[model samples]
Target: MYKKVALAIAFSPTIEALISETKRLVELFGSELILIHIGKKTDELETQLEEIIIKTGLDILNTKLIWKEGKPVHMILEACAEEKADLLIIGALKREGILTYYLGSVGRKLIRKSKCSILTLIDPRVEAERFSKVVVNGTQMEITPKVISKALKFCQIENVSQVHILNEIKLYAFRMATASKGSEDEVSNTRRKLIQDEIVYVQDILKDLDKTGLKINIKITAGKWAVELVRYCEAFKADLLILGDERGYTFIDRLFPHDLEDVLSELPCNLLIIK
Candidate 1:
């Protein structure tokens, strides 16, 4: 689905691993790779980047390298827009501290404001690893089908074996169902019915998808969406988690902490946020 993939390059310890992952994604998606570095252009830096590209098995001549001097977040987002990047890959910490939540980090800012889809690697390795288990947010939204489709496309390309689609039942709905003066058995039945309905909803979405060679598992979860999502991913030992950003997030939402914010604060796995 990604026609052009971009990597926000930083000469950090994970640079080699990041480049290797980016190269693999570009080759898999059949996309033009764009490397964006937010720093002054220097011959030494250029040479180093070239060496890394060659070492990572990416053709330096074929890759588009961009060097710009500006703020890291602004420059990276600008480059992604200018390059018309369908997907932007960047390295991210597995979990950010409390200070980062309020102050905002480069990775979080990019996730909040970037116009294109983003893939944040929590633990990038020099030797790229395969994504065998994938968990997709099957929340009931207009953008859910598109998110699932993109996830399935990636799974087909990567040959993922296990795919779990998680649909969450809102806590408020459950509260409302039990608010009525009902017996314990009635409340239990209400919860069971809610879970069944969510399963059917997810199945309907998957009915039109091409699930070839994939073991599809539909899970109906309850409680806070983001917290439950993280718990599910951890429990399932998912290598990748795909989520749909139907509506862009705002600063107020960040302060109050919404579903996306909760997930962003502590990534359970390599996150793929589809816009």
Candidate 2:
């Protein structure tokens, strides 16, 4: 569960979803809410924010809305850090002609740069929204335990009934794609054993969370991780997706699945990325 949630607000169609999601979380965690909007403090913007506040029933005394002038990603990240926020929620700004709504420049930057967790809503106004079905990727070998523990705790608090751990087989296959294997049968056997081992590992990892009454599942799929992960989420109708940041935050330095550009671009559900 998050303690302090900072909302990165902007003047776009995405703002309403940001506000709505923020409101839900604020109520859920009773979190200290901080709204950061990066732009000139214009009277028009002030009136717009006022309307949002009224609609969301935000207690002005508790909610802090900061209007800053500068680069949006930098300011939002800075503000959240200064406020000691645990999670930062932002909407995915759709780029025209893109099959999926890719994170806007600011959002992409934040995911890469922000030290705290980020929740990106692909489309915010769902008829009914609950993170009942959640998926978390456990491919970052270094942080698998930390990520799983964090995700389990989140699921326990969010009342998530079903949770999935996505494990990828990217090592040998990527290398073998160019070279010939010893034999078809040998390769198949090796792959099957790998899958079984992965399941055992995931089951062991999830033992501590079993008492939480959460249904845990492990999926071992071939091909690029981003592609397999996104396909599983779409087929499963996952409500929220969680992944860790193993790479740097700059647009070029991130670990966004080199072959799966459309993973975020055409994502089928909301996403929560942690560093």
Candidate 3:
């Protein structure tokens, strides 16, 4: 789905792993690779990058390298936009400080502000493994169908057999249904019906999707959507977690903590935010 894939380059230990992952994605999508570094470019730095590129087997001639001096976040985002990248790749930590979340780290800022889709790699390895088990957010939203469609297409390309579509029911709604003045049997029926409705909703979305050679599971979770999403991914040991992001956040959203904030605070795995 991605045409031009751009990576935020750093001289950290994870650079090789990040570049390796980017190489896989570039080859997979038949995309052009653009490596962006937000700092002064030096002969030493260029030599080191070339060595890594050769080691990673990324076609040096096909890759475009960019160097800019400015704020890291601004430079990276600007480069992505200038290059018209369809996807941006960055290495991410599993958790960030609360202050970073409130203020905004490079990763969090890009997640919120970048127009292109983002892939955050947690614990990236030089020997990258294929994503075999993926969990996609299937919560009823305007962008959910597109997100699921992208996820399925990615799974097909990667030959992933196990896929889970997770849908959520708000805890308040579930509580209201169960706390009604009804018999115990009635409460049980209400709970079952709610779960069934979620399943049906997800099934309807899947009806028009191409799910060939994939074993899909539909899961209904009740509670905070972000919390349940993280729990499900951890419980299933999902290799990647895909979700849709289209809402714009305001100051009030920051204060109240948006659902995406929860996911960004502590990533469950390699996260792909489809915008």
**Candidates 1 and 2 compared by TM-score, better number:** 1
Q: Could you tell me which 10 consecutive residues in candidate 2 have the lowest summed lDDT? A: 252-261
**Clashes (N, CA, C under 3 Å) per candidate:** 0, 2, 0
Name the TM-score of candidate 2: 0.86
Query: Cα deviation of 230 in candidate 1 (Å)?
Result: 0.9
- lDDT (Cα, tens digit) per residue for candidate 3, span 110-190: 888889999998877888778899999988777788899999998998899799999987667789888868998998888
* Candidate 2, residue 171: how far the Cα is off, in Å: 5.1
Find the candidate with the highest lDDT and give its number. 3
CA displacement after TM-score superposition, residue 218 of candidate 3 (Å): 0.3
Model 3: residues with Cα > 4 Å off, grouped in runs: 94-104, 248-257
- Can you write out model 2's per-residue Cα lDDT over 1-275, one digit (the tens) per residue? 78899988878866766687778777887788999989899898898988877776778778888888888888888899899999998888666886666766676678767899888888787233668999888663656676888888878777898998998766676356436646877767767777777777767777765446788888887666777778889899898888776655445335465533556667768888776
In order of appearance, the predictions have TM-scores of: 0.92, 0.86, 0.92
Candidate 3: clashing residue pairs, number: 0
**Per-residue lDDT of candidate 1, residues 172-251 (tens digit):** 89999999899999999999988988998888878998989998898888877678888899899898999887664444
lDDT of each: 0.85, 0.77, 0.86
Ranking by lDDT: 3, 1, 2
* Candidate 2 deviation (Cα RMSD): 3.4
